[model samples]
Target: MGYVPITPFRRTAEAVCVQRARVQSAPAPLPVVSKWDILSELTEARAAFGLSDRDISVLRALVSFHPGTDLGADPAKLVVFPSNASICTRLNGMPDSTMRRHLAALVASGLITRRDSPNGKRYMRRSRGTATAFGFDLSPLPRRFAEIAEAAEAQRSLQEEIAALRETLSLMRRDLLGLLESLPEECQDAALTLSEDTRRLLRRKAGLPELRQREAELSMALTHVPPAEVISTEEMSTNAAEYEQHYQSLKKESSDSEDDPSWYPMQSDIPGSENALAKKKAEAIPPRIALRTVMSACPSLNDYAEGPIRSWSDLVRTAEGLRPMMGICRASWEETKRHMGQIEAAIVMAAMLERFEEIKSPGAYMRGLSQKAARNGFSAMPMVLALLRREGTAQYSPGRAA
Candidate 1:
């Protein structure tokens, strides 16, 4: 009788061989399955176990060596004995040294086990017309199929959650930017700092917990912002009366005669002349709040400005430049000018610019405001005062005289 030679083994390799033997001898029922199904599950679960692309590629080459596509057709025949040359050919001509390293990785990962022959050569032994493979055993793959599928599902869920977080972060960034532009200087600076922090987190591709924390911080900051207050009709009437009284007092101080030809122009001097009255109204309307202040209140207007609006004239020119762009025809713009006068028209344009996101159609909105002005129902004073309130400016002084 001839004695069978025992193959020498390292401790880890021996342990893996023992485990594969145990799995192979188990009485558990084997179901019909395909090699591609096992490979697909392994690929999806690879990220969870920190497996590299090269490791997966090597596994793919090993899977291709099975005689048939079905993995469960014969559990005992799950072993493959492909040579290094064959594996390299299947792996797009991988070098022998690199193939050995990846093969070792597959063994270490417990996905496959080496079933070496006595002489360390990979081959099948035939006895009584039955062949037994002696090389890489793929039995562990079927044993771990359920676990791999679960891990793959878990990884997919995590990726979906990350995608949702990223989308929410993008919207939060846009809202924060718009809010910062509208906020008072002190508040804007604080919000700007928060925005920068958010941007940094986004750039780094921070995890869900860190991104959610930053989003909560930003939402909390937004909650602390005071809501803008609308100016009432009664307040406007009172302000108009006070302004008229102040104008009268200033006129009295400057001249004793109310009928002075040079001091006050008579209505008869320019009877039924809307342009003269419009000019007088424009001159009396007071310089609007500073260009810097107005731009802060209506940052969208800056996009239309050809240069920095250092003065009210620059703002007017920018508004004029935007008039055609906003689809406000010349006739409509002239009508707005006729009703509201130049200064008030510019101020209305600035206010419209501030609410650009809310108003879908700029031209239509301007036309609506123009109609209100024609009916004596619209006043730039309230809009300006509301903006001043938003800026947290307590004193509502008119702009400097031109």
Candidate 2:
């Protein structure tokens, strides 16, 4: 030999040795394929194939060194013969150590194979009338094209499912917020389960199965919540205007009186909700319900009030003071006052206070009712009457005098 330059040595991995034997013994006969197209599919499904960005980059550089764009011209034939330095240059000056590491990764993944020469160098040889090539064979790539493409398509479908589930969860979250108060007190277990599932999605990259399971659980939880109340924009706007009128009429009145139309919105002033079940015509509110009845229905007033709770004004004042204590926010309290009129809002509060131990969140309770008032005619009489039945007190006949 004239001269042989010193070169770095690398131990042949047993896995690589096994792969080389497999390729020689029974290479998966495959049709010639576009190298770039195979690379594109590999890139899309890299994660599923246990490939990293650097690994793909090294493979890309190796593919570039191949003689043509197509692979599998001859399954047993060698592919590229570029040196380490040349491949590194194509990879934007990646260090030799990094290139070698990623090259090993590609080999282990079976996307490419190493074809080392007798002296561990990559080159071609010619003997008399025959020629042989050796470097990194890309035949393995086209052989596994169908597998890789299938993985890519599956990944795409998984991503789509995740996006769709996220949208559904988002809508459910909005519904939960709107119906927070309206749900029956018994729905806590379902709500809690849904909360935990949603929290997981927010915190991690949950898989498709995980997401679908959560969605199913949330759907079941939602079943416990009241029927979906779809309030239209026009209806909400009309309700808002009607509330404004109630406030104006209250402002115009010198004193609270049952005769005032503002105090009790007529059956016609309130429209039925969109739900057929909620479409039943609302009965006219009694012109006069006694302060004594409210007191009998809610005895807790003695605890929250400083002095004797006498008039509707005194009840309103006491309820206002107790609003903060019950954890009801200003916005909720004000909306309730405006929508239901001061006396009704006050009675609702007193009823809630008596059952405060049973009620979890008073603020949400007030908001749920306020939302109901917008969609339909919500009256405090029902709430008060429910309490009277619980207390075993004589029912306040709506036809009786003030």
For each candidate in the order shown, give its overall lDDT on alpha carbons: 0.65, 0.65
Model 1, residue 17: C-alpha shift (Å): 8.1
Off by over 4 Å in 2: 1-20, 24-29, 74-78, 186-204, 228-402
Per-residue lDDT for 139-219 in model 1, tens only?
Answer: 778777787889989867876777666656556654554444345656765665565566556555467788679778878
Candidate 1 regions with alpha-carbon error over 4 angstroms: 1-27, 182-184, 229-402
Error of 1 at 167 (Å): 0.4
lDDT of 1: 0.65
Could you tell me the lDDT of residue 399 within candidate 1?
Answer: 28
lDDT, residue 131, candidate 2: 60
CA lDDT, candidate 2, residue 105: 82
